[model samples]
Target: MSILKDKNILLGITAGIAAYKSAHVVRLFIKAGANVKVVMTPASKDFITPLTLSTLSKNPVYSSFTDEEDDNEVWNNHVDLGLWADVFVIAPATANTMAKMANGVCDNILLATYLSAKCPVYFAPAMDLDMYKHQSTKASFKKLTAYGNKLIPAGTGELASGLVGEGRMAEPEAIVKFIENDILVQLPLYGKRVLITAGPTYEALDPVRFIGNHSSGKMGFEIAKAASNLGAEVVLVTGPTHQKIENHLVAVKPVVSAEEMYKEVHKHFKSSHIAILSAAVADYRPKNVADQKIKKKDTTFTIELEKTKDILKSLGEIKTNQFLVGFALETNNELEHAKGKLKAKNLDLIVLNSLRDKGAGFGVSTNKVTFITANNTIIENELKSKANVAKDLMELILKQTHA
Candidate 1:
């Protein structure tokens, strides 16, 4: 049995000189037992054909997120594609593609998949040394890290431009091994690890419904995926959703309610080098949960509510030197509250989400966020896709790791 058994992996090909090597990367993903689907940027076709990738992946390739091809019974749905995968890997991600991935330019289907993906993604850079070493490219890399995406460092090799230093994509074997070593659940956590709690935790009132927010677990899963890509063993503790992490690169422990989330995260937080409490945890749960569906008594029924366990605070108490990151989604006074949580929870940094802004926050393909560190350093960003948002988060984590 393979570690990637029965998993959905989206292979995103960007415009790059080394697009040719991505074929080998696809081959490796397939050999590892993943059901590979390919998304190609328009420029990538200049280097490789859809037919070639289709033959390799055994699935029809999709080029645009919104393209409805002739005679196609089922229209291309980016949400369906996003929900379809266990992981999204962008091999030979060019400087242009990487920049777009960071900046939220949905020029193609590959970028849309990155924007909407609710799972782990691996962004592998492939470009000429000069272009790769440029400041813009450097910024793009930083942006990706800030979003909590794994960056597979490019290697040195002969370049398509006849000049090279360190811009080749890592070998297929090495990339595959990166997935195995970083993502797969290993006993390494028994010694050292990073724990992440993700998705949306519901506070139920009755059997049929509950008080919950739309987390979708997109960013949180991106963090786990990024950490796994970087060789840090990860544990993803997630809540209820249609999402499934089977056969993932890392150990995934699923739970539903706030109580279950507390139990699971508390059990493993101690061993983590870092813990990102990214789940949209319910702040108030029903004071009394009904075992059966509550019947409507009148036009309006009132119910008492209680505060949820302060997961971050509890973790902060016994957290020791381990790192902790928090997320704050606000309707108003976004920066103020996010900064407050950074200090109150003993977090190194806290991500800010403003529901007031368009194309950002909760149940959408795009996000506009601000990053606040414990030092009160504020970095403001514009509206971009979530995949790029993921990259930006990864950079912050890397900075923290280095610091």
Candidate 2:
């Protein structure tokens, strides 16, 4: 998925020949799963109609401070519009608008909204080569950039005056890509790789039956999503579960047994900066497996079991410059056992979940956890949904790793 997914984009249009391209910009943003709202200078309507932009964006286009409906004037709040946006992009920003923006001009609703916006603002200049090269225009660029507004450099192309030079607004596709890259580079986890394990490992006894737990893989899946959103490339090794995810940054590896999960995790652990093992892997498996379903020929049945490889401990032993985390779900002596495991397994941190606490443990959407660091520091957290828990865990990891 595009990093722009679910972002609120406020598109500002101005009076310039390139204003016609703003329609395509809105379409591209919407296609990338962003919510778009258009704010246009009144004169820009001459190039592109508000009706067309409104139709594409599925939201009312704002051009003036007031709208006349049934002879009633409904005021459009510029401050509200500015506050609602996660990002603001002014495309085809005319020389007139650029000068005004640099000088604190707020005559138009678009300008007013820009002045009031607290989010990052990006402006794409559009003008003839001569006007773009003018000393005043150069000063505007310097002033706006010095004020922290990003500039999408104008492309070199044929201008409205039939002269070919660098004054044309960037193409819609280029504009969207530029913004996505800018947002990603600023994220804390950008360029990091995370390895995560999730779900219940199934140990099969026969073709018809196997052993597994009630783990829904909800918590681990949530962590994968959280990590991906923070700009990490994730390798999620998951066992049997109905949980699903749709992030481009996450690669899902399906495993059926504890053995399979162990191998998959190790494959990616060496290159990972962080590894979080949350899978409820079976401690034992049937020593001998039947080729086919075992019919109940007798009233009773017994099968010998053997210890499965401990994935977390193995990773901890070989870890080098990698932050390793583990999960401990205990019914008794929760803190003592969790702390023991944190040190015994060589984990940097361990998340402790007590079945004694209501709304916690397997098959539930909520979790109450206590974090135990390797240094014996303990931090308790309130009951929260799995998604929020995932976010909290990531925040803790960020602080510890200084990523």
Candidate 3:
């Protein structure tokens, strides 16, 4: 998959003849698997229509702070648009727009969004040769770069003024390639291998029935994606789950019973640099399973149970260079029990989830967790999407391992 896959790109279009190329830019970003939204200066519309941009991006193109036809009743929060983007790109950046950006001018929605943006900003300048070489334009470039905005240097080619010079906007294809290469090479886990287990394993009692838990496997799948985003090669040993992951770096091994999960986990564990066991494996399974479903003839039926293999504990016993992590789900004595598991499982870190916390527990997208370190230190986290929680977990893992 492209490194830009799933990325939120906010494209800003400014008034310039080169603004015509922005349609191609949006198309390329979409083709590369990025979700794109366009913001245009009012004057830019003369060169390129909002209808065309919106049609290509499949999202409303914003120019003004509110709908021009609407009264002052509606407003577009510039800060929200700024924060929603992972990266902002202003292709065909005019000298006027560049000056406004460098001077803190926010009269237009595009400039206001730029001022409020928390993500990286990239601008490609486009103008005639003399205008591009002007001292003011040069200063704007220097000032914006000093403020941490990336400037994609203009190409040398024929200008719209019927003059050949170094003021053409970089091609759409080149700009996307540049960003992809830059982002891919900076991933934190670029060379690491991660092994993860997820979902509720089923222990067969009969052909028609089995034992399982409420786990939706969302947490494990989120962790796998987060790790893959950081450039890790992941082996995900998952139990029955409706969840799916599309990252090319993650290789999923589906399993049914606890024994199957255990075997799959072990098969990839030794090759991993980090191992996280998040599967809700059964503690006890039916000692004997019938080949045929038992008829409902008896008033009461009984089946013997036996302990399943301790996968985490066994990994702890044989661990070498791997940084082992485990999870603890508790309702009572949460911290105490979590700490006990952190030590008992020989884990370098343990993430504790409390069923008592609202928005937390199995089958949900959100989680409230506490992190217990090997040194007995504790870090509590507020409720967050499981995806963000997974990000925080990976950050901790990187810190502990690299420390």
Candidate 4:
């Protein structure tokens, strides 16, 4: 039930002495199944090293605005970072950072990224007790909140300055709960069951090899996480992945092939309010399979092809109150083909991807998609991280689910 599961949450650590506690915060998010990334303020570097945070996060630590490591000077993309995060969390926020947030200061890379962010930003302030209660500090916080940022609301306890009153940074566990609880309250699909299919289903042509895609199930896993965050009780049917499922609340059922996926999907999908078929199920399979591996490399060899069951169409016939979503991958005529599937399959919506796009389609960290509904309506967007794309998809479904 952790809110951080499969979430792309970026942690921004400022120069406060409390910066030491960010390690625990990172651990909490990681335990919640989030892909945690850290941005350390130069001052924060004094309190904690990039190596330490990087080790916990398992992602690169971002610091300088123009800093680059490789020869090409192709630096970490701050614009991409700004657009990638589902939520931006500034833990151990200092008065300097708070004041900069209030006045639009962009002195550091972290601050610059904050200025450029498009997602929800949250801050947990920490300072000396008296400094926290100052009129100036209060006003800065008020202004930042008015700009649509959220306050994680610091705790009251002993301070680093040796005086006991207020200004303690919120505990990592408490911050994790704050995020989860907030999301749980706004779940659009609350009480509604969601069934999703993810990963590449291996359609066996023979024992030695089978037709499959490079889907690691990351996208599908992300969808399940988003649905759970939005309050749906999710059932994830995944093919395979090394990544662990973040939310224990969502029931996960694993499968290996199209038939397996269909069986598991249909069993639970009967009660599901929504279904997103993101699995790369084989459209065609060998008509007959050899029991043993077909040895020898033959330049010319052919296997009879047969169509696999159309899971979406089959479900559409039995669907009553459920919403059906399909996915389309095309190299040409992308929109026309996607719209066709939306109508023919009786899908409420279809997500379209073209291999022509750089970050989209199979085996990419980022994606660019055009969401097409049953009415032939379209909502197109530029490339974004898969995390953001998943969140966007969830929001649209929520609009429909709520409506």
* Best-to-worst ranking by TM-score: 2, 3, 4, 1
Worst 10 residues of 2 by lDDT: 65-74
Model 4 lDDT per residue over 1-403, tens place: 5766677999999998888899999998998778888987887999998899999999989988655566666576677888889889999899989999999988888988898899889899999998899998999999999999989988988888789888999988888888777667666677788898888888887797888878877788888878877788899888766545757558989887788888888898778889999888888888898899988798999889898888888988888899999888899999988988888888998999898999888777788999998777799989998878889998998776662
lDDT string, candidate 2, 1-403, tens digits: 6788899999999999898899999999999899999999999999999999999999999999999553678899999999999999999899999999999999999999999999999999999999999999999999999999999999999889999998999999999999998998899999999999999999999997998889999999999999988999999999999999987889999999999999999999999999999999999999998899998788889999999999999998999999999999999999989988998899999999998999999989999999988888899999999999999999999999999
lDDT of the candidates, in the order given: 0.81, 0.95, 0.93, 0.86
State how far residue 214 of model 2 sits from its true place (Å): 1.6
Over the full model, what C-alpha lDDT does candidate 4 score relative to the true structure? 0.86
Predicted model with the maximum lDDT: 2
**Candidate 2: misplaced stretches above 4 Å?**
none
Residue 368 lDDT in model 2?
A: 97
For each candidate, give its TM-score against the true structure.
0.56, 0.94, 0.70, 0.59
| Per-model root-mean-square deviation over C-alphas | 14.8, 1.9, 5.5, 8.9
Worst 10 residues of 4 by lDDT: 240-249
Which pairs, if any, clash in model 2? none
Tell me which of candidates 1 and 4 scores higher on lDDT.
Answer: 4
Q: Whose TM-score is higher: candidate 1's or candidate 4's?
A: 4
